[model samples]
Target: MKEYFNNIYLALSTIFIGMSVTFKHLFVPAVTIQYPSVKPQLPTRERNRLYVNMDDCIGCLQCARACPVNCIEIETVKKIPDEDLGLTSNGKK
Candidate 1:
């Protein structure tokens, strides 16, 4: 008889705890952001991809040296001093 009452009390306590959490959240406003229609602008400092500026690059292979994975492969050919390599977009040779 005592065991039966203890089991009943335990079940009622579990149900009360569960229902309290459910009711608490039921009245709260949703925090979800709707995608596609409400696109959030990313910060300017956010870097998602690597960007290489070829014009400014002197083929120094510094990136390869800094990489721990050795994934970057670079080859450079020394241009002849008199050869016109053409100007970059910013007009720098």
Candidate 2:
């Protein structure tokens, strides 16, 4: 008999607790945002791309080492100080 009453008390107390939580949430303001109608603001600084100028690259593996994806491959010929190569597209010798 005592165990039966304990079980009934436990069930009622759980139901009361659950209903209190539900009532608390029912009175709270809704935090949901209407999507598609309102767009979120993006960050000002974008790091979505990596731009490199081949003219300025000296075949150093620093970029490859710094790259997170390890996708950068540099291939260049070492030119002699006296050797004269044609001007680049930017007109730099």
Task: Give the per-residue lDDT digits (tens) of candidate 2, residues 1-93.
Answer: 999999999999999999999998998886876767876667988466566777666678778877889898877789999997666658786
**Model 1, span 23-84: residue lDDT tens:** 99999997887966897789989755444577767898977876767787888989898998
Clash list (residue pairs), candidate 1: none
Assess the local accuracy of residue 14 in candidate 1 as a C-alpha lDDT between 0 and 100.
Answer: 100
TM values, all candidates = 0.39, 0.37
Instruction: Name the runs in model 1 displaced over 4 angstroms.
Output: 1-48
**Each prediction's RMSD to truth:** 17.3, 17.4
Query: Once all C-alphas are superposed, what RMSD does model 1 give against the true structure?
Result: 17.3
The TM-score, computed over Cα atoms with residue i paired to residue i, of candidate 1 is 0.39
Candidate with top lDDT is 1
Off by over 4 Å in 2: 37-93
